[model samples]
Target: MEKTWNNKAWFMVLPVLLLVAFSAVIPLMTVVNYSVQDTFGNNQFFWAGTEWFTEMLTSERFHSALGRNLFFSFIILLIEIPLGIVIALNMPRKGWGVPVCLVLMALPLLIPWNVVGTIWQVFGRVDIGLLGHTLERLGINYNYVQNPMHAWFTVIIMDVWHWTSLVVLLCYAGLVSIPDAFYQAAKIDGASRWAVFRYIQLPKMNRVLLIAVLLRFMDSFMIYTEPFVVTGGGPGNSTTFLSIDLVKMAVGQFDLGPAAAMSLIYFLIILLMSWVFYTVMTNYDAER
Candidate 1:
C-alpha cells in the first residue's frame, strides 16, 4: 500500500518564512537597491551600477579596517581556543565544584553586550577606574583614550573577558560528553595525561573546538559595540574593525550608497571566510 503525505506541515512553516522575509529579506533587498544607485536628495536616484563597490574595493580605509578585523580575529582564536580547552580540561568532572565552576563560567556570558562595553569603558579610565588607577600608581603609562596600543590592549582584554567563557562552556560540554570507557581504556593502555589528551580527549572535542573557533572568529571579526564604546574607533582609528567602519560610513557620514555596498561586501567576506573555516575543520575531522 502506498502512503499519503500530509501537506499541512508547510502551512505551519509559512509564518516563520513570512517573518524571515519581513525581517531579513526585505532589508537586504533595500540594501541591494541602494548599492547600485546614487541619490542627490528629493528621492531622486540615478543608476550608478558598481561604482560604489569599485570605490570601496580601492579604498585604503577599507583595507585598513579589514586588516584590523583579520588581526583581531586571529588574536582571539589564538588565545581563546587553547585557553578554553585548558580551562575545560582542568574543571571538575564531578561533585559540587562542577556547578560552582559552571555558574562562574556562565556569569560573563550572561551580561548584555552593551552593558559589557560600558563596564569596560569605565573600567579602563585613568582617574577613577580601579585598573587604570592601579596601573598609573604602578607607573605604567596606560591610557586607552590616548594611546593606540593601550586601546587595542583594552579591547582585546575586554573581549577575552566577555566571550572566553563561551569557548570554555563549549569545550566543557565536549569534555563531559566523553564516555568513561575511553578513559578506562586509555588508563589500561598506560597512557600519560598528555597522551590521553592528545589521543582521546582532543579527538572527541574536535567538533566543539570547531564550533568555538568559528563562533569566536565571526564574533571577533564583526566586533563593534564593546570596542566602539571603549575606544570610539580612535585614538586614531587603531581599533576600527570592519563593522565599526561600516557604521561610521552609514550612520556617521550618511553615505548610504557606499555604506550599502560596503555592507554587502562585508556580508560576503564573512560568509566566505566562515565557509572556508567550516570546510577546513570538517575535512580535518573526516581525515582523523
Candidate 2:
C-alpha cells in the first residue's frame, strides 16, 4: 500500500516560517550588510570588504574578551555538571518529595535574568546589602563594586544558583526514564553504588547531559544581561566578556562595522565550539 502525504501541513507551518524570516533571517542579513560596509552617517555606505573582520580578529581587546568568555564557559561546565549530577543522584526518584523538589528546582529557572542580576547587585552592596553587610560585620572584606575578583566570584555564584537547577532537572529526567529492572539487576549482582553509577547511570544519562551542557554553554557564552546589570562589565573591565565588549562597541561607541564584524565572529565561534563539543561527546558516548 502506498501512503498519502499531507501537503496541507506546509500551510500550517507557513506562519512560523515567515516569523523566523522576519525575526532572525532579516536581522542577520542586516548585520552581514553592516559588517562588510562602512557608513559615514546619513545612511551612506561604502564597501569596506573584510577590513573590520581583519581588525576584529587581530585586536587585543577582542582577544581578551574572547579569552574571558572561554574561561567563564569552562568554569560553568566544570562546576554545574558535577553538582547537578550529585543533586540528581540524591533526589527522591518517586515520592511526595518529587514534585516539591521539582518545583524548587524550577523556581530559579523561572526568575527573569535581569531580576536575578538586580537581586544580586542589591544583595552584594557593602553599605546596605545583606551579604555585603554580613561580610563586613565579620571583618571580612567583600566589595563587588570596586573589586574585580569579588565581581567575578559573585557572577559565578549567581550563575550557579540560577542555572544549576536546569542541569539537575535534565539529569533527573534522564535518571527517572531509566528502567527499574536495570537497578534490580545491579542490586542482584551486588554492584557497588560507585560501580552502578559509573557503568550504568552515567551512560544512561549521557544524552541528556549532552543537551544540558550545550544549552548551558550557549547561554553562558551569550550572557550579557546579568553580568551587565550586576557588574556593569566591570570592576574596571575585568568582567567584560565578549557580549559586553560587543555591546560597548556597538551601542556605547556606535562603531557599527567593527561591532557587526565582532558579532559575526562571536556567532561563528559559538557554532564551531558547539559543533566540536557535540562531536566529541557523541563519539565518546558511542564508544561506550
Candidate 3:
C-alpha cells in the first residue's frame, strides 16, 4: 500500500523560512547592492560594476590582512585541538571530579566576548597586570602596546585561554559516549595505554574533533572583537586581520563600495575554505 505524506508540517516551517529570509536574505541583498554600486552623500548610488572587486583582489592591504587571518586560524586550530583533547583525556570520567571539571571548563565560555578581551587587555598591562609585571621582573621586554610581536603573542594566548574550553567539552562528550566494553576488551587483550588510546579512544573522538576543528576555524577566521580590543589592530598594522581592516574601510573610512566588495570576497573565501575542510573530512570518514 502506498503511504500519504503529511504536508501540514510545511505550514509550521513557513514562518521560520520567512524569518530567515527577513533576517539573512534581506541584509545580504543590501550588501550585494552596495558592493556593485558607489554612493556619496544624499543617498545617491552610481553603478560601479566590478571595479571594487578588482581593486580589493589586488590591494596589498587586503593581501596582508588575509594572510594574517589565515595564520591566526591555523595557529588557533593547532593549539586548541590537541590541548582540548589532552585536557578531556585527563578529566575524571566518574565521581565528584566530573562536575568540578565541567564547571571549571565552562566558566571561561560563559564570560562575554568583550569582557574576555577587556580582562586580557588589563591583565597584560606592565604596571598593574600580573603577567606583564612578572615578565618585566624576569627581564623580558614585553610591551604589547608598543611591540608588534608582543601584541600578537598576547592576542593568541588570550584567545587560546578563552576558547580551549569549548574543545575540551566537545572532546569530553565524545570520550564519555564510548562504551565500557571497549575499554574492558582492551584490558583483556593486555593492550597498553597507548594502544587503547590509539586504536579505540582516538577513533571514537574523531567525530567530535572534526566539529571542534570546524567551529574553532570559523571563529578564529572571523575574529574581530577580542584582538581589536586588546591590540586595536596596532603597534602598526601587525594585528589587522581581514575583519578589522574591513571595518576600518566600511566604518572608519566610510568607503562603502570597496568595503562591501571586500566583505563579499571575504565571505566567499570563508565559504570555500569551510567547504574544502568539510569535504576532506567527510571523505576521510568514509574511507575509514
- The C-alpha lDDT values of all candidates are 0.92, 0.94, 0.94
Tell me the spans in candidate 2 whose CA falls farther than 4 Å from its real position: 1-17, 277-288
lDDT of 2 at 259: 99
Residue-level lDDT tens digits of model 2 in 119-204: 99999899989998999999989999899889989999999999999999999999998899999999999999999999889988
lDDT of 3 by residue, 1-288 (tens): 998798987899999999999999988899999999999899999999999999999999999999999999999888999999999999999999999999999999999989999999999999999999889999999899999999999999999999999999999999999999999999999999999999999999998888889889999999999998999999899999999999999999999999999999999998998898899899988999
The per-residue C-alpha lDDT of model 1 at residue 82 equals 89
On lDDT, who's better, 1 or 3? Answer: 3
Candidate 1 regions exceeding 4 Å error are 1-14, 281-288
Q: Report how far residue 194 has shifted in candidate 1, in Å.
A: 1.5
Model 3 reaches what TM-score against the true structure?
Answer: 0.92
TM-score of each: 0.93, 0.90, 0.92
Models sorted by lDDT, best on top: 2, 3, 1
Best by TM-score: 1
lDDT of 1 by residue, 136-159 (tens): 999999999999999989999999
By TM-score, the better pick of 1 and 3 is: 1
C-alpha lDDT of residue 204 in model 1: 86
Report lDDT (Cα) of residue 106, candidate 3: 98
lDDT computed for candidate 2: 0.94
